[model samples]
Target: MAAGGEPVRLIMSGAVVGQELAAEFGPLPPAMLPVGVQKLYELQLEALGGTRQHLVLPEGYGLTDYDRERLARAGVEVAPIPEGLRLGEAVVYALNSIGAGEGPVHILHGDTLIAEPPLHADDVIVGARRSNEYAWAEIETDASGRITVLVDTRAGEEGREHQPVAAGYFSFSSGVELLRSLTRMRGDFIAGVNHYAAGRPMRALGGGRWLDFGHLQTFFQSRLAVTTARAFNTVRIDGLTARKSSRDEAKIWAEAHWLQEAPPAVQVYCARLLGFGAEAGRSFYETEYEYLPVLSELFVHGALARQPWLRILASCEAFLRTCAQLSGGGSGDAALKALAADKTAARLEAFARETGFDIDAALSLEGRPAPSLRAIAERLVPAYDLQSGAADSVCHGDFCFSNILYDSRVRRIRAIDPRGLVGERPTLYGDVRYDLAKLAHSIVGRYDQIIAGRCRAERRGADFSIAFEPIACQPWLEAALGEMNVRGVRGRSVPVQAVTVSLFLSMIPLHADKPERQMAFIANALRLFLELDSQ
Candidate 1:
């Protein structure tokens, strides 16, 4: 609640660094991405008591319907800043458009978050941080910790090692008073504030933790910090700022240090819990049959890397062996029957037509209708028919590259986030070939490529490769193929490459929200199936 006892929260959404963030990460606006369980904007707003919300967005950053709906659900009314307007103009425009009433307007920068926020009813409160960087406006507070003046740190000035800088957080008792002040506001918000702050009582609350997500380095560091704090409940801080890669390395070092010297109770409880979980998981395999499922290591020894083909093949072999115990390994179950029952054909066609990827562009199925995809899916999916029968087993239903963490330094691969039971199936087990195909989707389908910023790839029939220009992916593809331990197709293709293509089709419905990813999965599945068909 504000000083007037009415609820109002104003959040500035578009950052000047949004384009840079998109280039580094995906196209998600900074407000939308995860910071622990909450989004960056969600964390900021949560600090303020729930109220009528005003979100300021820049026109350059495209707002999707999903983004708009999400913001609405979060109790926000979005005001898009025209492309030509500056940040100051945008803020003012948003404030006016949202009709911020006579109550206090809780204004916060979308790019920064405070571990301990100092916000109150009436007086102006600015979060001050002790920083070595001189890029920000400096805050000089009086003996009583009252902000006397904010120094504008000019560019090319040498940075002081320990200095106080203003972290952007503001609360105004009167929206009318703030609006009057903002009319004369310059691009520099703090400097502009000094004009209005003359003789006004203001407090400089200082704390050790402050994250400014304006830069890519700070953004990732903030993510790492919040995630670790959520997971381990504490972060060992070596220093505040560094360049990007070394900064993450420093955080990893801090994590390693804490792991060594953390409280024994913490470590012991973690161990006991993991032990119990592992025992319970193993019991399922032991009681059901002799096959061991994909096991995750309780500890990760090094940085997470991509799944190694060797570990993937080994896991598949074990899963396949387990399925060999069942009657007719490739026999279709109810789930498989339902999936292969032709409902997805229109969905595939609609996706293809929308994305400009032709499903029947296949040589044999040229100019074929949407049912052509359904026909191919029937071939790839497991069934009782001899030609389409898939060698079945207990499968990791949701296996993907993200769940597979490998440590190249330690030469170890750990599987995390196993799908315990899929689709109300009688048992956790399914098709062995599906497991093999899913792994292939990660390796051959280049699922990790788009995420790694090589967003586009080339596909022709069964052949798929990351089409990263100025960098050939042939060697990577060859190496991935070399790791397959299948009976006849090593060094050329996965023996179940056709089966993998089918699995790719099955992956589309799983990513209902990520339409582009779904489209890519659909296109690749069709291409791979066509390659097998031609052969």
Candidate 2:
């Protein structure tokens, strides 16, 4: 109702099949009309903040038989009309006819849910509206103070003027004259207003957030957008920080108390224990503590040293022969078979038990089944043959980046991680290409870091003869063959390394994890295998 004492009546129209609209009028003449009018009248009196002087005409009513019965019980005045008339149009006609001479009539859509009482008659209220070049549907305004419109340009060719403006909402003056004038417009009432106002200046009221439950995609997108926004806000409110102060402190302490040099007697003792001859033992001991002097001469001075390949093969053969001799093995061929069949598991178990270490657990984590000690010995036999077939020379048992120290000034390579022992036969040997290949592969894989940068042959002074190189890995087949030679074990090339690389590539989806490198490695291995099989 207007504050100046003019009577105000709310005219609700449109298909009212649902009880949503009629249910709002309590204890007053039912908007649908019949018995419940008393209760509806009371509701209207309470809602409008006035008495029963105003007449309520809710026209354009469309309700199911059941709903009609309920409306009749509520004492609503039902308007009689042809069954097929468009409900929206009929409602407009009814409101204009009934409220023509009234002080002012406010027409509201029945489908719009109003959470609060109607505004004062003089104050205009707006809902949501979307605008296109040809037509606009008014919608609720947003807080940004912008009139948003859902513009559809698809019909511009059909003589529909399209413009981008928020649609689905509008407001007009509640003056009796203005109401009569609006009611006189003939065409689709909503479209008439939009068309009439196309070029005129109208006060624009902004819209708020709104949801149209008309489509599934819109529903889902609304939910997702809201959820994402909330999550982002939460993360912003509660940030994260790193925690490694204790570790950093420990590292600092260790560095500060580090020893500059080791005792002279320690070298002699290590050499003797390692079974190296006096001079070789001394060299090994000195090299272990600092390999710069030796590496510098080899890499920088280009010292005439034995080829790395020959050394690798020779060392492998030597290790196998020494094991066979210790076990009272008769011949190479016989030893190989025996070693393969030997109960190495029990030996490895015994060693672990004696040392109080969990070798099985550690190896399992590396994706390698713990092989028996005898199986290990047998694997070494093929390596012995490869060594003997290649050449006899001093082999760096652990030929890897960490084991070979570098002197930047001299640019030499020196073998630091050495296993000194004599072999009874000429061992397989070649250039250092394979070692370099393994190193390259290792660095890329970051496997060394995972293994804690420990020497493959010595962990807590325990002798384990597996070595890894960071960078400079050989071709798959050659590396496999070299490994077989070093282990003194022979078997048909199984494509194990290639398969492993493929598995790794597949397991990691991130491109930065080296998918291409792994793929290339697999391809090369497959090519080599196919060629070998053909031969």
Candidate 3:
């Protein structure tokens, strides 16, 4: 029971998310789609803030153990209902199965997340947003905020042009009343809503930010709205452009300069820089935004089929091979050593100081003996030094899957968000092997899965064990790694595995917000280091 004298049970109707979205985001419902590092349902649970949360899934919809675990952690119970039922019937079936009590029943369409939902109100409240799109249910409210008429605009109706519509959430006084209204209307959701509204004053609650993930365009737009930024920088997406700004002038300026100074071959593979500016002591740069799915998303979600995955890997191999040709003749060796040895050591030390993890101590990782971070760095000094006296080339310093966007329509890739620095210097070129290590870290290292919360790491003192939820593209990943290793860089054999492990160690401090993520990185680094040492 809540403080408002009515027990609130949040019913998230998942069947409405549709098959189109399901195909894009793999097997998950819209509620489970990744919004930055967390799921959409995770954000919704936090925003809605209730103890009794229930999800309604279509009949025979299978959930993985990982999915069940995450839902369990969030205290959400599942109710599977029969398929082919109308939206209203589905909600009623869900309510009957979950036993919605004599309290407030907050029905949220799974595809929508209201930032500040109007809950426990006296009147029946329907969440509203003003939009001209015919996909939504139109709502006409009187001056007193009561809904006079509600229409399902999807029935091929003429356009009202920028009217208030139901934003896929409604709060009823009790489940009993809602069920009666629904039963009377014969399970037509909008008609039931109209019937209920006619009997009682249904107010329009339209005060807060409401995100709709029902359509492809709106889905991407909502995802951008909720994405988390780095500690030092912020990115805002508006219309067809994205602007990244930072109080650290050097970082932002460097990113802009790298995009500008990239050669023709490199520029063809990256986002076009729109412009740069300074506003209120912050430096900023804008770029043309392409609403393409990031490789990380597609990879982790099992969204692309096996052949597409192979083609993407092939495309990436071609891009990196092209980059290797833009050599600066070993000028970046010193920078590479600084990054692989010096900066990595410093960052590991900083991570230790921040988390009290003792990186100097040895570890027993996954039943295998692992060396301390200091020892690993010591051995890697010579390994990274091997890249010296070899050809260096133009680099996308952060060439990981997450930084690359793939457009399936054109079968091309666009790289975004370069590291913009090599050992504290802002430059466009580095040892090409460093870029290879970044890609390896994503594929062989599973860095993006950790970022996407698809892995678990548990640590007891210096002993650690971690496992990523099984991804569907394992064979493709192995093939990609084999291709990369065989290709090497500029026909020179580089210690990519060793450098990839170091890359994981170096990025620990950058993700300090989630300690579990930091620990996952450490565990993954140890695992990779053991494999490298054995080889």
Candidate 4:
């Protein structure tokens, strides 16, 4: 609430200079960029507290209806101001356009977030941090922490050794007073902010745990800090190496083996295995660290045009083809069947036993009748068979978008986090269909988006419905899948969609940590099955 007993309004400025990020991380604005499992806007909303908030965007920004609906659900109103305006001008334009009443209004920069925000209704406050890396305004505070001056560092302000710089958060006592001060300054954001501070007793609040995504270097640094780690593994990253340790010794050992034994065709597309050891009864291995964007982020949140996405898929297809050609083993029909029918059945049973949600019953998906999980798995076995004399290929068993990293500079991708084990045995070879199924699950199934919270599922016993946020990449993904089907594995038809559905069903017990995720997996599995059953 404001000092006047009205709800405090927040105007979040997302119209920062973001050409560098756009060129590297696809075409989305900085606020919409995916960082780890959440977008920057979602993280900002969680950090900045306010009941009513307006996200100020630049003109000509193409926000999809699904994106708008998601933002509205989070209680954020989108406000677009004139393009190419100065930060101060944009903020003023948004405030005026939104008709912010004469009450306390808080301003937060979209590219930054403060972990422990120190905002109060009594006085105006500017959040400041001790950093000199990026172009941030320097703040001068009096003995009582009252801000006396704000120097715009981007305007050639000489350094006096990295003092407290404004970290892009502000609190105002009166909206009308701020408007007058900003109007007098005439589009000079820093000057207008200084003018407002001069009139009011503006104080400096030292920001604690500030995360900046304003610049390229700091963007990757902050993003790496928040990357979610899998429950079974612990990864420690340094300047040159990423060390992965796991209590499950077999998992770690198999991963190391796969990395080391990978042929040149596959090894060229993977991180080099550095070393391995044991400590404190846990197994550990290190890999060369490369700062690259995850493939899932680009596909889910990136606004890149169609051709670029198709190009990436083409590169992936080439890699998969090479995997089949160079690393073929004996025909593993029995292994494939066991993975599809036996493993899925056991996992589904375990899922029901643990969660008390029986998935063996028939479900309705998108108003279409879908059969039970067991029946789906049973029918999916015929699709799991590799054609006669076709050898099993050495595969990155968990070849999903999340496990793949893309280097935009070279237009190349690297695969990480291989499944490593095939039926409790440490081996680099598996049914090529399994790898195809994994990729299918990412694109056609939209599993990565679901993990990133871009999906909704409503479940009541045996009935379930699911919907994912519509993305621009959908048609491109469909084209890629169509192309993949035309170029079948080893000149034999592959049941990628059927095997993909089975993958989702079998992985339910492993993701018990996130019940929502488990349900989402089931819901998605049903959706895919409905499509297959109709066909």
Each candidate: what lDDT?
A: 0.49, 0.30, 0.76, 0.76
Q: Point out the higher-scoring one by lDDT: 1 or 2.
A: 1
Model 2, backbone clash pairs (residues 3+ apart or across chains), number: 114
Q: Which residue pairs in candidate 4 collide? A: none
Give the per-residue lDDT digits (tens) of candidate 4, residues 289-385: 8777788888788776777777777767776877777545555554566556677888888888898775667777766777787778777777665
TM-score order, best first, reads 4, 3, 1, 2
lDDT of 3 by residue, 392-494 (tens): 6778888898889876667778999887787767877777678878888888898988987788899987888999888778657766566663225521134
Clashes of 4: 0
Please identify model 3 stretches exceeding 4 Å from their true place: 1-13, 16-23, 101-103, 142-145, 155-158, 277-279, 300-303, 331-335, 349-359, 382-389, 485-494, 512-516
Clashes of each: 7, 114, 0, 0
What are the candidates' C-alpha RMSDs?
Answer: 14.4, 29.8, 3.4, 2.9
| C-alpha lDDT (0 to 100) for residue 260 of candidate 4 | 93
> Model 1 segments beyond 4 Å from truth?
1-3, 15-19, 26-28, 34-38, 130-134, 154-158, 206-208, 228-436, 439-535
TM-scores of all candidate predictions against the true structure = 0.49, 0.25, 0.88, 0.91
- What tens digits encode model 1's per-residue C-alpha lDDT throughout 1-535? 4557664566676554455454333344456554433457766766654657776766676554544566787777776677556555666677777777677766767777776665554545555554334367777667887767777776457555465677776666776666666667654466556654664656666533787766655665565555432221222233332111122233333323322332343222111111111122122110111011111110101111234434444544443344334433435344344333343454566556556555554322223222345567656544222243444444444455544433333433333333433343323344444445556565566554443333444445533443331213334543654565432224234335655666566556556656656646655665566566566
Candidate 2 TM-score, true structure as reference? 0.25
Query: Model 2 over residues 458-511: C-alpha lDDT tens digits?
Result: 222222223332222233324444355433323123222222222222222222
